[model samples]
Target: MLTLYVDAAREPNTGLSAAGAVLIHQKAQQQFKSPVFQSLDNHAAEFQGLIWALEQLTDHQDILTVYSDSKLLIEALHKHYAKHYQDQVDRILFLLASHRLVFSQWLPEKDNLGAHNLALQALKNRQTND
Candidate 1:
């Protein structure tokens, strides 16, 4: 099974957000993070992170499990609807169309340290670069 852990961070002061993820396949893991183009609410940021992580996948897998700390992102994906983030939901669905099987679960923050920390680092890096 291919598993991905995703998280997002937003700094209120700087109005900056970033996405982070840890992708694992066949016992090998890769971590990645990137700053979002625009600042958004936590919900939007989470969706962006998932989108970013999904885009990083090179090939299709039999099953893909995404672990995220944001309930809105997981539920939105499952239901294919997000009241305020409908555009993001559509973007996610389009990206997910290539996969045979994909699902997301709500992960506890404490257990999601890797992605959380990476997201923070992404935000920090973006801040410094600016």
Candidate 2:
């Protein structure tokens, strides 16, 4: 089974956003963070972070679980949601469907601090670049 913890952060004033993910595969762990491709709200950044992590998959893991602090991401994956972000949601679903088993769970901010800090660092990197 593979576990991924993902998070995102956005600066309200700059609209600068970032996404991060911590991937645990077998006995190894990996971390990733990047500035969001587009200027998006925090919710979108969360979705994007998960997407980024899913895309990083190489060997197909039979069971994959994703942990996120974004309620919107969890709820949207569980049920039908607004059309505004249907495409992004669809992309995530498509990726999950490729795996033999997939699970999405919500984690508290405290429990997800590692990913959260990575996201903040991504935002800071963007700030430095600009």
Best by TM-score: 1
TM-score of 1: 0.93
**Cα RMSD to native, each candidate?**
1.3, 1.5
- Which residue runs of candidate 1 sit more than 4 Å off their true CA positions? none
User: lDDT of each structure?
Assistant: 0.86, 0.83
Cα RMSD, model 2:
1.5
Per-residue alpha-carbon lDDT of candidate 2 for residues 1-74, written as tens digits (9 for 90 to 100): 88889998888877778888888987799889875566557787778778887887875647988899898889
Give a tens-digit lDDT track for model 1, residues 33-99.
8855565677888888888888888866458888998888888888999999999899989988887
Count of backbone collisions in candidate 1: 0
Q: What is the lDDT of candidate 1?
A: 0.86
lDDT, candidate 2, equals: 0.83
Error of 1 at 78 (Å): 1.4
Using all chains and alpha carbons, the TM-scores for the candidates as numbered come to: 0.93, 0.90
lDDT of 1 at 115: 95
